[model samples]
Target: MSRVVFTLALAASGLLAQAPTPGPLVRLYPVALDANGQPVTDLTADDFKIVDQTKPQTILAFHKPRNEPAAPHEVLEFSNRTSGVTPHATVILFDMINLLDADRLANWKALDKALPQLESGESVYFYVLNLEGALLPIHAISPPAAGDKTWPQGVATGFDKVMKASSHIRQAQIGAEEQVKRTFKALEDLANKLAAFPGRRDILWVANGLTTVPDPMLPHCNGDWVECSLYVPHLGVTLAKDRVAVDPYALVGNISPDVNYNMDQMALLTGGHFYSRQDVRAVVNQVTQGAVGGYSIFYDPGPDNWNNKWHRVHVTCERKGVKLQLRERYYALPDSRPAVERMKAVLMEAFQNPTDLAEIGVRTKISPLPDGKPGVHLDIRIDPSDLLLREQGGKYSGALYCLVSDRSATAPLGEPSVLDLKPELTAEQYKMVMKNGLPFMQDHPTSDTAREVRVIILDQNTNAVGSVTFSVK
Candidate 1:
């Protein structure tokens, strides 16, 4: 049996320079804003205070946006993208579930003016939530065509079609409670779907329901204006998992004190900004800017902090007049530990949807093993510069967890092979790998079958994943 081998400049160090797979730590994402409502990216670790369950926790790691040069070395055969930048999208989700006809007309007028003003180089999608909480795509979500500048015309065309058909369809006469339930369900479904996208997406939720109506599914019965209306309690956590921000833009006639309060909660809970008194184009630009300039906070809450209850998380900047947008609460009891179970889920998701992941730059080649043994050789080329590495005590360290498997074969190569490599290197070795990417080699015993063979890799530190799937005949 052949074991996996990594070829790189990893010197033998006694200080445990090879990073160990760390336990799950709390990761807080905060989007800071200036007094004029713009993303603030220059703040450092000392500028903020984070309190969990009313107790201050020491900041273990602070990660700014990955501003490194995305270009790979000229010697590498393949990298993440040839475009030299990560692709993002703007999703405009309009809620037509309970909109009055007059309000719809007003939105149409505003959007008509805003559509021509919308400027973007990334993907953009437009959809509507129908009466039954099903998404009706006005313009389906897709990556922008290379060198295609006519997308704005396509958006105008799609909107024109929806406008012509709007007069014929009547709004469903549903109860307030049912409408609220449907709105919550729509948001849940949308978040799950958006997880497949590549980078962080900004959702322009042009809705009249989620903010204007109080949640009916919340178990408590206190009828206070803003405090009583919890949007089903679990909605915030669900949105946070998908790496998408929910920027709520209320319709013209739906603005109320209760509506504004609920809208603020939706934005705060999902690390998004409320687009009040703004046009569609301006809102998209600001939200996109925030996504580009957000910062991530990592703090290790010891095992004793898991009290199996919901804990409130408060992040405030020491600099006055600066506002921070972040998730307000986190459940103490996560679904599973990250060592085995969470790693398994990450592998499965990557293998199942290999094309959707590209954070870690990787390329692969498969062929018959040279040892005259009945096995196939698998070689993976990894770009080390894309990984999140930590430098401590004159050494650089990073961890990688990988899986290689084929789900279709039962007679052979059915069982998934899991490999974890945590490499620690001296400063010289780190410089060598940075100049020339790292190479990985492995082999799998298999029979003659043409099936989907997938190799999934996960960067343990940042949870960045990449995969490659090919058929072996």
Candidate 2:
């Protein structure tokens, strides 16, 4: 992945504060297949039970896939929903980084033959998992097409580019250890990107299986300290070194377990499926034909301590002869600075992609600044209620982290700003703030060549993000 550098500056505002209390609600996307391996869509909330850490939890809401709008509207509406378990779109991820040359070619051939069978009303996205561990979107096929028997022109063009890029991976001289790291990094990045989209995304991962872990004894450890040895002169002992053997397959041995676990977890968490060296054409056909069925179950797993623990989840149905395909565990994110900082880093990495994180609602306006330094006055409006806030000393408080970048140059146009929302307001002032929304304005210096401006905002309390892009003419 590429690094996005930003110079951050704090704007004096009242909202700067610590994290808020953890919220309720843990959502799960589970697909139930009968003895025949077909989706059981008729199951209701009463027919299902969810166990978190072996404790039965109430199912607060359940949504089964239903008829939705076609094409662009369907994509737009699905992405915009505040809550619900609707089927979003299918993202066919070609993991070229992990697949051997022959497997890559075979999977490519499978996809080539299966593209024409895509459902006309479904939005399907194509991505190539590059060696750098990024799920790069090549093309998106929306609905209302002439027929299901053909692919859009863009799909053909994009697939060609994807194949061309992936072909080089076959010749690239990357070791198994490096490959393992890149593959999982790609999966992790892909999950974060998909989280912004509402509803369940069927990720048809096409690749040979990846190593679940990488060897800790490998030389030039690539920042993986666990695999790096530490020589302590005082103790006269080398820690974390079993032997100095140049075993090419060592990476595979170390990573295979983790790769398997992550693949399964990724599928469950994203409400997708993992297909390892399977008949890609058949899987695509099955997915497009609606042969697979699932339900989105939302429930409150209760309050979390944010101690960064993995909570196990088990789902079963009252109906007999049904097999559940779902993620077995979910990690509770750490509330500490390290974890939050890591999340911020991940969010910054995702900024390089074309998709904007619009999970949180936001509106922006930009006008030329009067100072005449090729600058613009930017204004943003955010609803206070949409944010998670804590009350202390008779005042509401929150923090907002904002980033403004020149997309044309892929550089920060101005220092990133942090706005604090500590307000000890009177009853009338509180009403006004709630009624009118929290408003923020800043002047940013821009170059004459800048064609686009990207603004990203992160809610410190909830970690919710909202982003907007403006074209400069």
- Pick by TM-score: which candidate is best? 1
Best candidate, lDDT:
1
Q: Write the per-residue lDDT of candidate 1 for residues 370-469, one digit (tens) a residue.
A: 7777656777777675576789999988778777766453222445665777778899988888776666788876554536566777877656677655
Measured against the true structure, the TM-scores of the candidates, in listed sequence, are 0.77, 0.51
Which residue runs does candidate 1 get wrong by more than 4 Å? Answer: 1-24, 32-48, 72-76, 81-86, 142-149, 163-167, 209-231, 303-310, 317-323, 331-333, 336-339, 359-393, 404-417, 431-455, 461-464, 468-473
Q: In terms of TM-score, how similar is model 2 to the real structure?
A: 0.51
Each candidate structure's count of clashing pairs? 0, 19
Model 1 lowest lDDT segment of ten: 7-16
| Model 2 lDDT on a 0 to 1 scale | 0.52
lDDT of 2 by residue, 77-101 (tens): 1222232223354556677766665
lDDT (Cα atoms) of all candidates against the true structure: 0.65, 0.52
Give the deviation of candidate 1 from the true structure as CA RMSD.
6.3
Q: Which window of 10 residues has the lowest lDDT sum in candidate 2?
A: 239-248
**Cα miss at 40, model 2 (Å)?**
3.6
